[model samples]
Each structure stands twice: as structure tokens, then as C-alpha cells.
Target: MFLKVIKHKTAWLAVLAACLSACNTGNSNRPTDTPTSGTIHISVDETYEPLIEAELKVFHSLYPNTHIIADYKPEAECFKDLLNDSARLIIATRELNAQENAYFKQIKISPRSMLLAWDALALVTNRENPDSILTMDQVRNIMDGTDKERKWQIVFDNPNSSTVRYIRDSLNKGKPLPPNTMAAKTNPEVVDYVARNKAAIGVIGVNWISDPNDSTSIEFTNKVTVVKVRADYGSEFVKPYQAYIATGSYQLKRGCFFVLREPYRGLGTGFATFLGSYEGQLVIKRFRLFPARINAVFREANIQ
Candidate 1:
């Protein structure tokens, strides 16, 4: 009887020990996962930082329980973050290519891509510079350092930036950018460089310089002039306004995409879907970028 009682107590002790061990190693046996309510990280192209930051502010206000961490870098680095699982989403100028799609297939993940807004690659010059208008060909030649019209110095944010890539692929037909391409650390720096140098032309995204509601825009434009660009020779020059971009008059417009690779309905999906929502589209318009889906209100008003 004594032996049996001792055996029973020992069994109870073993059971209690197992329970304690399991309790201490909470969720250790379960796979790591993200949910809509938890914290998550994303990567964005630095060119679009201002817009994304606004969107995140609104998103966080709405979803107070969810915290989003954003790392703004070159577009290439954003893609790398997505592949390495360091980021659940990436905002960039382009979608994943066939090679990237194949890698996702091999990894048993399907990347979701959504176009969030229409943005333009704005060309800017010093406010004091009289050369405000340029033909697309001239711009291309300047980029390639072959423009004999003037000793041109083209400035861009980063060598690997999406702005540079877009210009290179669109204007140069996948050719390498010219040696005259001067690199600035950021779009604002590009503006600063152009503002200080009379011969420099800064190529940047329009959002950085178009929002009248934002003081930064005033500061940027106060220092430099947003050069009007013609689509081709003998074409009318146009600035990168929302109307111009929407009407296909903005010559350097590009689409911004949200590339999400979340396997489950996680925070990434939530954010991507939020960006495509009507409210999200409104946010895009508020930031002076044309929404992928038109959602702006138009109320007729007469002024005397």
C-alpha cells in the first residue's frame, strides 16, 4: 500500500512537471505566424516615404492594436527584404518579375501585387535657371551625358533608386545611366543640389514636391523649379499634376505597387487591402498622387 501511494505521488509529480515545462515554453512547438492585430514590418522605397508615412499614421489610428514598422530604402533593398522574409510587404515602382514569381512558386508562396497610386518622375531645375522646358529627347540625352546643347549635370536621389531605374528603363531602353548622373542621398537632397547649382537638373518623384498642404512641398519648390517636360519633340510641355498624370499628359508617370507575400490573412494583407480601399484611394489623392481607383469627391463651386 505504501509503495502504491509513493508511485501515485510520483506520477502526479511527473504530470505536474510536464505541465509546468509546457507552460514555460509557450508556443514553442507552434510555427511562428503573424496576425492582423499584431506587429509587423514592411519596406518601402524612400521616394514614397512621405506618402507611406501618412498612410501609416491613418492606419495606426484606425487599428490601434496593430503596430507597423517601416524601413525606407532603395527599391532593390525592399525587394530583397520581401524575399528574405524580413518584411511582409514592399512598396515599389514595379511588380515582381517572372524570376521573382518563379522563386515564390518554388517557395510555395504567391505574392499579391496591388497598384496603389499613379506618380510621376518629376524633373526639376534651379529656380533661377531659365531653362524650364525640355523635350523628352533632350532629357534622355542629358541622362546619357550626350547632350551637346549644354554642359548638363543630372542629379538623382540614389543610383539604385526606383526613380533612376524608371528613367533608365523608360528613357534609355534598359541602357546604363550616363556618367553625368550625379547621386544625391535622397529626393530632398536632389532638390537641394539642383537649387544650389545652376546647371544641375534634379530628377525626382512628383509627390515630394506637389503637396500644397504640406510645408515640405513649399520648401522644396521654393528652392527649385519643377521643370515642365514635353513628351516628345513639338509636344506641349506638361507638369506632373494629378490631372496631367490622369490624362496621360505627364510624360514620366509611373505606377506605385504594394507587393505582399503574406501566406495568411495577416497584417500585410490588411495593409494592402486598406491601400486599395476607398479611404485608401482618398489618402492617395490627398497626398497629391492619383489613386489607382478614382475616389475623389467633386463638388461644383462658383467663384465671383
Candidate 2:
């Protein structure tokens, strides 16, 4: 009888030990940070500085406990930070490719990504420059240095910026930039260059000059004239307005993607969720960019 009692107690102790072991394993896999709290580092493509700054400002106001440290740099640098594990989240123009997916799989992390907004590249020139309308063919010619007239000088925010990559991959068809293509350090520098040089045309993100509520953006618009673009010679020229961007009238449109490498439900995931949420989408809409995550309705209006 005593032997039977000893065996039963041993079984009970074993079961208890197994339960504790499982609990420990689960706790180890749990995330250290919660959605509404904790500090995190993130990298954002410099093209999105104004839009993201507005987002972070509102996020901080809503969740006082959470803090996000953002580093705005060229798009290539943003990806490097993600690959090196220096940033938990990154705002980029594109999502991960096959190689990037394999790298994350090897690290035992399944990265998450979502489309946040539809962005556009603005072709800006000096206010005094009369050539403000361009067709897709003419723009291509200017970029490839085939425009025999060479009427305008081309400038980009940075050599490694997504704007340069977009022009090369999408418009230039994987061709190298022309020898005369200039590189400014930042988007603001591109604007400044165009503002000062009557013959210079700057390629920059639309968000820089699209924010009506932002004083800096308003000032930028006043400094340089945004060129209207048509898909072809006969199509109507359209600006990168939200309505036009939504309807595919704008010719140089791209997507804004938010990628997170977090292994658990951390602050990075929280911020990514917020970017797709209705409130966040509203913020993106206010900046004049088309929000991709939400359904937006537009109506035509006439004024007397």
C-alpha cells in the first residue's frame, strides 16, 4: 500500500514539473514589449519624412507611454538598417523580395508588411520655368538624355533614394541615369535647387508639397511649380492630387509599404497596425496622399 502511495505521489510531482516547464517555455517566447508601451527604433525613407513625422506626432499624443525613435534616411539605408537588425520597423516604397524573404526565414522570423498609402513622384521646376506640363514620353526622354534640346537639367533627392530607383526601374527600364543627372542630399535640397535654378527640374515625392496644413509644404509649393504629367501626348495632364491618384490619373504613382520584423506583438507591430487603422488612414488622407487600407469615396463638385 505504501509503495502504491509513493508511485502516485511521484506521478503527481512529474506532472507538476512538466506544467512548470511548459509555462517557462511559453514565457520565454512571449514578447517583452506591449502594443501601447515600450520604446522602439524605426527607419523611414527620407521621401516620407513629412508624412511620417505627422503620424508619429499624433501617435505619441494618443499613446503617451509609447515612444518611437525614427531615423529618416535614403531608402537603401532604410533596408540596410532592417537587414542588420538595427531597426524593428521600416517604412519603404516596396515590400520584401524573394531574397529578403529567405533571409527572414533563416532567422526564424516571419516579417509582416502592409500597404499604407499610394504615393506619387512630383516633377517640380522653378516657378519662372514655363514648361510645367510633360507627357510620359518627354519625361522619359529627359531622364535618358535623349531630349535633343536638353532644355532642362534633372535633379534627384539622392543617388540611393527610392526616387532614383523608381526612375531607373520603372521609367528608364533598368537603364543607368544620364551622365548629367544631378543628386541632391535630400528632398528639401532638390526643392531648393529647383527653386534657385530656372532650368533645373527636381524629382521629389509629392508629400513634400501636398500637405495643405503644413507651413513648410505650403512654402515649398510657393517656391517651385509642380509639373503636370500625362500618360501620353493626348491624355489630360493631371497633378498628384488625392482624387487623381486614387483614380490612376497620376502617372508617377508608387506605394508606401510598412514592414515589421518583430517576432512578437511588440511596439513595431502596434505602429504598423495603427498605420492601417481608420484614424491613421485619415491622417494619411489629410496629407493629400491616397490611403490604401481604407475605402475612400469622392464626389465631383462645381463652384460658382
Candidate 3:
């Protein structure tokens, strides 16, 4: 279960979607009871390795009999797993598009999608680089492929990753990505690359480098410093800390979604619901990402 989903775990393990009639008829492969125990595979966006891995560790600790094989990849590949039934459960940044829904409908797999967490896209640079703050305008210009005077190299976890899509579409507003953009195989690679290259800036999910209490995040902090981003509508420059992400001060924020294509209350349903439960929300909070299912408050009071 402690698989390093760093660069790549395996090639696309595609499979056929299980039909509804077969599942409804109490198929031998699917669960029959409340589904507290079983072996299943869940696909996840690679950017979420830190938080998702933590959650699964606790889940497995609680349910010693249940086994969950997690395949972490770029967002597009995760969606492919969901579509082909190689993974009945997936954690992604968005829900199924209309065409994806239509495809599932034809296959008789009604997917249950829900928001699990709120994660901000974090920009990072080497500790030696003194320029730590980036305005949303500068961010847009860098990705817009129009600025020639300011040649900043931008790196992402993967080309098809949600972080890339958010930076390219949400930030650039449909502008073509600049030729200076680069893709690392994984989030850690982005951090490592930025840490080694003073001129490069890396974009990643906040989950990777948010929590000070987390050992992995602490290592990331030691490697490179997270870049503070100025809000498009405000003057304050803020990092992707929990407070900034929750208060909307961090501009490049996105949602975490769990899309399950389970016909019955099987293992997929159980795990999906587990991710939104109270305990689950607490786990997410510890990682510094906002929990979507439950209310979490962080107050600021002067110590005097």
C-alpha cells in the first residue's frame, strides 16, 4: 500500500466497465452486504498523493481485512481508469463532462460524484530566489505566451494534470501555453527541479507542500519555498496555507472530487463515503487542505 506513485507506477491498466444488470443480479465479483470489507482499486490524481495516501493509511489501519490498490496518475489517466472500469473509484479535480456522462450512461454505470476537499494550486521556487510573490496578472502573462521581456520557466507535474489545466485554462483564460512551460513526471519532481534550478518556478497542488506537521511536506519545505500569490481582486499576497485557501486569498484554488461508478452499495461506495466522513475531513484538515464535506474554521486572534 506504500507504493511510490512518484513518476509512474504502471502503464494504463484498462478494463471493461461492468454492466448494471450483472451487478444487480448479485454478481460474484461485487459486494453483497454493507461492503465494509473487500479488495478494490481506486484511481487518484497524482497531485493528491500526500493527502490521499494519508487517508488510505488510516482507512487500512481501521479495516485490516479490506485491501485498496491505489493507482496515482495524471487527471486524464485517472478519468480513463474510471471510464474503462479498471478503477471503479477516482479522486479528481472535476466531475464527468457531458460526453463522459453519456459514455457512462451507455454502459449503464451511474457515477456518484461528490466534493471531497478544496486544494489550492501552489507556486514554488528555489529558496535562493528572492522573488517570492507573484501577482495574478504576472501569472496570467507568463502562461499567455505573449511576454518576451519576462522569460520565466514554468513547470508542472504533468501536461495532462489538473494543475496544468487550471493554470492554462483558468489562469490564462484560453490562451495558448507558452513554449517555456515544462512538465515533470510528478509533483516532487517539480519541487526538486525548482530547488535545483534557481530560474524555474513550479506549480503543484497544495497537498504536496502544505502541512508543517507532515514529514513529507516538511521535506518539500526544505527543498523549495512556496510562492505567495496576489489575489486578482485584492492587494494582499498569500501562500496556499489553509487560511489563505479557505478565505479565497489564494487565487489558483481547485476542488477535489470523488467520482464513483458503483451500481450498488459496494466497496466503492463505502470508500467514497469514508472520504467525506467526519474522520476523513479531519485527516484532510491535518494536511492543510479544506474539507468540502464538513465545516472547518481557522480564526485569527491577536496574541498581544
Candidate 4:
């Protein structure tokens, strides 16, 4: 009986030892949470949502463990979110200004801004419209409501949009946008307006007029015809093709930036790296935007 009791005690001790060993080994083997690999809260400008969404889908496929919660807002709203530290990432057409950069530095988070892609500011018109090309000066005259011939009727989204700002800055040359130019609340509304108005020309980001592979792109192309813009008569009235934008033929182009509050070390850093990587740039190319990589492939593609 004494020997049996001793054996029982030995068995219990062995079991405990095994469990303790397992607890220690399991903890050591478990994956650690990376600052950049976990759930990331990001804000995206509405104009870039489709491209971002497509890219995110590809990203998620590769890193299924990572989660991204994205809020789509206008560029101004995105900047506001970044300022408040409400988002770890902001994808927009513009970069931080000096004041905004100083604010980030004050907060002890000097953001790393990456220019991922180039997008064109495209002008659109109805398919039946005879004029398929316009000079910068002609667009300016129309926006200023000085073109008495009414050869170009202007239609666009909200005044706060990048499209409006580009037209106002480029065409108006710092002058106020003319009252005759119509402003719709949304891109779809602008498209609808232009579709119904034969003479009206809609100005929007080139992403809207992307090719038929993507649903949003198809929708825009079906509704309107993208007009070519020329710097002058000798220069080509180049449409916003990916190759054209990449090679600098498309003059009205903007950069898409990813602004992080701090030098991303974890998930933020990882995502930033991904955006600058070949795979991310491939997604950008697929969206018909000019990727920053500027590889030979980008030069060869005819993405119109």
C-alpha cells in the first residue's frame, strides 16, 4: 500500500510538470501582435475609395489576419481625421501643408507621407457632344463664364472637391469659379447632369472614368465620354491614360498620398511598405493610375 501511494504521487507530479512545461513553451511559440499587422483604422478620401477598396481586397487575401477598418470621407474630412489622430492612415490626393506638418511634429508624430499613385483630373462630356478636346484656356474661359459662345458648359461635383479646386486653380488662375458652372452634390449626380445636358462638360477625377473591368469605372464610362485636354496646339490633346500620366503627358495630374501620424513601425509601417511594393503598385496599375514605382512595365502598358 505504501509503494502504491508513492507511485500515485509520482504520477501526479509528472503530470503537473508536463502541464507547466507546456504552458511555458506555448507562450514562447505564440505569435506576437505587431503594431502594423493588427486591426488598423484608416480613413480614405471618397475619390480614391474604389482603388483603395480593390487594393485592400488584394492585401486582405495575402494577410488574412490583418483587419482594416476604413472610413471614406472627402479629402478635407480625411485631413481633419488625421489631425485629430482618429486614423492611423489617410489616403488622399494632397499631402500635409507646413502648418499641418508642424502640428504632427508638435504631437511627437512626424508622419511619413508616401505618394503611391498619380491620378488625372479628367473632363467629361456627353457622347453626342461634337467637341472631344479642349485647350486649358478654353476650359478657363468656360469656368469664368466669359466664353460668350457657350461652347463649353461646366458641370462638377461639390465646390470643395479636388476636381473643383483643380479647375478653379488651373482654369480660373486664382479667380473665383464662375457662377454659371453647376455643382452637383455627388459624382453620380454630376454624371447624370452631364448625360442629360448635351452641351455640359463634367470635370472629375480620372478614376471615375476608368476602364470597364471595374464596376465603378464601367458605370462612369457608360454614362459619359472622357474629353482630351491639350496644353497647346502643338502639344497633344492627351487623354488621361495611365501611360500618358506616367510619362507626364497628362498635365492635370495629382498624387495619392498615405499620411501616417508617426513613422509606422508595426502594422502601419507594414502597410506603407506594401503600398510602395510591386504588388501594391500592380493594383494601382490595374486601376489605371500611374504608380510611383515608374517601372518599364508601366511605360509599356497602354492603359487607356
Each model's lDDT comes to 0.85, 0.91, 0.84, 0.78
Worst 10 contiguous positions by lDDT, candidate 3: 7-16
List candidate 3 segments past 4 Å from native. Answer: 1-34
Please, what are the lDDT tens digits per residue for candidate 1 over residues 1-304? Answer: 9999999999999999999999879868453434447788899999998888888988888888888899999999999999999998999999999999999999999888978888888899988889998888887888777788788788989888998898788888888877777899999999989989998899888889877788998899889988888775335888887877876777788999999987777888888888888877888898778898765544556998
> How many collisions per candidate?
0, 0, 0, 5
lDDT of 2: 0.91
> How high is the lDDT of residue 146 in model 2?
85
lDDT of 4 by residue, 137-210 (tens): 77667778887766666887776777777666765788887766777867777888988889888877777667
- Deviation of model 2 at 235, angstroms: 2.3
Model 3 lDDT at residue 286: 87
Model 4 weakest lDDT span, ten residues long: 29-38
The TM-score of predicted model 4 comes to 0.81
- lDDT by residue for model 2 (1-304), tens: 9999999999999999999999999899677678889898899999999999999998989999999999999999998999999998999999998999999889888888889999999999999998899888989999988888656789998989999999999999988878888998999999999999999999999889988889999999999999998875346998889988887788789999998888788899888999999988998999889999899999889998
Worst 10 residues of 1 by lDDT: 27-36
lDDT of 3 by residue, 45-124 (tens): 99998888888888888878778889999999999998888898999999999999999889877889999988888889
Model 3 C-alpha RMSD to native: 12.9
Best by TM-score: 1
> Which residue runs of candidate 4 sit more than 4 Å off their true CA positions?
1-36, 151-153, 298-304
Q: Quantify how close model 1 is to the true structure by its C-alpha RMSD in Å.
A: 2.6
TM-score of each prediction:
0.91, 0.89, 0.88, 0.81
lDDT ranking, high to low: 2, 1, 3, 4
